[model samples]
Target: MTSKKSPVGGHIPVAGGMATKGLKYAAEIGAEAVQVFVSNPRGWAQAAGKPAEDAAMRESGVPTFVHAPYLVNFGSPTPETLERSVASVRHSLQRGAAIGALGVVVHTGSAVTQPFDDAMRQVREHVLPLLDELPNDAPDILLEPMAGQGAMLCATVDQLGPFFEHLENHPKLGVCLDTCHAFCAGHDLAAPDGVQKTLDLLVETVGPGRLKLVHANDSKDPCGSFKDRHENIGAGQIGEKPFAELFRHPEVAGVPFIIETPGRSADPHRKDVETLKRLRDNA
Candidate 1:
């Protein structure tokens, strides 16, 4: 197995291509890790992965992760949506395994108009079965809590425990804490010692080992705004202070951070990576 190096990186766009060129783009931007989509993030179609490309990725030594489709919402009221969500997760895991990815990230979707209890039950009934079916060699399934927008299932970090309880706390399950989402969901990551307090809560709730990934984004909206917009590092409501605190936190030392900030091209991403590295070194 390729060992993890530095934990800081960003989500490289698949503008060049998937797998092959994606890996090259990540390296060019100084990413020590990367997150990519195995298929259309907005669609349900499953694309066949290339074995040669997968092998190259494994040998490239960059820690990789696959983000499942955006349309996947196990808490959806529609039966078709729930069914497709499960299938998309399954396919994403398979692709992750093929590419030797460390983990597969999926949003802990919204409950919509459904009663919250009913939504949890839907996750238990529909989502747990899929989790049980994951291959032993498959990458860990990392659940990313969403912004508390319209009945979001795992809006707050505390809610992660209940979600895990529904999944029976499967060994392969993990958490991907998105800083921007957490702040928007009212985690108060901007306060004094805020990042440490947030990490403490995560460690207490999910155990330190399961805190596998961090989405290092700054929020476009203010705290508790329920907006999911992301801005470049140090450029949003979440300034550089919180990020420096995040890097200094002992629990997050080796955890991979993938920035989901916005930019027209690679230049912005490169700068973000450099900024994060500087923070870590200085911290």
Candidate 2:
């Protein structure tokens, strides 16, 4: 793929029940990229996609990313949940390919009641087979590290190495860094050099090449609070200054920074996108 500076965008709802509408909404808000759910985020059911809509999205020239269902938990203790999680990922990748998505983001899920070792074993046993099944042209499966809530698998940036090791460092595996989650998990993005330190840590741990997508949201809670609530850019605990640092980080250049903040309407998201673009341009 031809690379430029980093792309700034947001997660917009499918306007009027059409994926094309969502793409249009993203453009209306001056987004350079976009993220969308191919199916119900909270459900296991994968929706059938239309080729026309996929073609339209591809024709729109906006870089796209697909977020896998929230129900996916590859580390689940139950066999059925594990099976469904694998299936969901496969389905999401298939849809992502159809829409020419750069990556498909899935949460690095919790181990729940199981021991962390057992969860890693489950991830190896179940997730490896699914990875093996992917086509050569399939989009990268971007593992998003979660806030340090409950028994989350990749609770911090440093913990991602183990997850990649469990998968044998597959090329199809990558990372999606969420600013709010990173702060909530104790990376402290509000500090002057915090965004740089976090990006440097990520580059140190995963390498700059493996860093694929970014969820650029401010945190509603304090640093190390472990809450996952996402506030709009510049309006929460993360403030606005650090995002300039994020924009200036050399490692983050060409990565897609997607905002998953509050407000369902286009107006709020438009402002957020503008804010990020301004930061990026002036950085």
What are the root-mean-square deviations of the candidates from the true structure over C-alphas? Answer: 2.6, 2.0
Q: Which structure among the candidates has the greatest lDDT? A: 2
Can you tell me which runs of candidate 2 are displaced by over 4 Å? Answer: 1-3, 15-17
lDDT of each: 0.85, 0.87
Judged by whole-model lDDT over C-alpha atoms, candidate 1 comes out at 0.85
Error of 2 at 176 (Å): 0.2
Question: Where does candidate 1 stray beyond 4 Å?
Answer: 1-6
**For candidate 2, lDDT tens digit of each residue in 1-283?**
1225788998867546446578778878888999999889999897988888887877778888999999899888988898889888899888888888889999999999999999999988887787777777888989999999999999789999888889998878899999999999999888878987898988888876898998999988999999999999999999999888887777777889999989967888999999988888878
Clashes of each: 0, 0
Q: What value does the lDDT take at residue 236 in candidate 2?
A: 98
The TM-scores, one per candidate, come to: 0.95, 0.96
